[model samples]
Target: MNDQPILLILMIAVGLYTFNLWREDCKNAQAGKPSPSALPGATPASAKACIIAALGALVILIAETWGELRLGLSDQQSKITVLFGIYTLIAAFIEELIFRGFIVIENKGRALRWAGVAMASVLFAALHPFLWKWEDGVFAWTFSAKGWFSTAAVFASSLWFYTVRFASFNPHRSLLPCIVAHATKNMGVILIKGAQGFVVGLF
Candidate 1:
């Protein structure tokens, strides 16, 4: 069974859910309640936070994928890099909005907040196939070393994103920093992978 269709369907579902969250935020704003926008505008401080978060993500990615850094893409893979880049940016924004903006924001109280973060981080990690691959009929009970490492890395990254989003200076809890940081991380991965592909092609 081709997983691409399942993945595409999952992406659409996530996109719709994110859109609903944005709509709710708009409604809450109109009612004079505190709510974060899914696509909030970035302030200078948020921009700085974004840079910090992106750099942090890059460090984590580099550490996690160090051995695979030299792996290259095929000609077909190179051709799809642009499309993947766009998908990464949009997907990162939606994931951040859902996990940090909606999930974390909705759960009130310190205990609930931590619980929310933990649950969201786990869900975020699960969404990445690198961490847990689905086999012929089900997800594998056993993970490769890479899968375990990726899961840990993704969980940590999700926590980092939540921290940045929640710590925004904006009174309305803007998620711009999270979005920017996530996009930057995705772009960095794409660029690095593309460079690797070019180098391999030269040899």
Candidate 2:
């Protein structure tokens, strides 16, 4: 256990969240629709959504990995990256499928989907050790007031955008947006950190 306690715990939290969502996915599949692995053919609307999501992800990755803000492979840093990456990918897929796809479908109205997003955004903040970096993170956990303002900022902004993006298109099509937002958020953080380091190096 050479890793940081907070980071480790957060990783576990993400795992639990993802696992719970995966189980729900299994239940959804039992009904009729296919799972993420065997998702049916993409409709024209969904295909477009996917392309937009892919492009956004690409832009974020490029900004981080290519710019002066690139990350280093220090032991602790690498560990955090690997754990976060794995969790992010898993959580994004699971969370999106449940919150956006399944819940929206089962609820029969906007109420359920809105509730899901609210719940997801709140939970998403809790799962973060550095919640202060998002938007609503401040309201999620009070004991740790560290960077709470910043975290809240990101959460609100991201959620606002996420809601709008999801509303503009169908879940079958908007799944990509959620996936992209998750990936892009990770990449965006990395880029900011990288840029900071680059600036520091020049000082």
- Each candidate structure's count of clashing pairs: 0, 13
What is the per-residue lDDT of model 1 for residues 99-162, given as tens digits with 9 covering 90 to 100? 7765763547877887888888998998887644466668665556555666677888898787
Candidate lDDT values, in order:
0.63, 0.49
User: Among all windows of ten consecutive residues in candidate 2, which has the lowest summed lDDT?
Assistant: 71-80
Q: Mind giving the per-residue lDDT tens digits that candidate 2 earns over 1-203?
A: 22344665576586677556555554565566646663321122355565566555555445434432233322112223434444555555555555444544333577876676677666655555544233333444334333353345445544643553555554444355555556555655555455444212211
- The candidate maximizing TM-score is 1
Error of 2 at 60 (Å): 12
The Cα error of candidate 2 at residue 29, in Å, is 12
Give me the overall lDDT of model 2: 0.49
Q: What is the lDDT of residue 149 in candidate 1?
A: 64
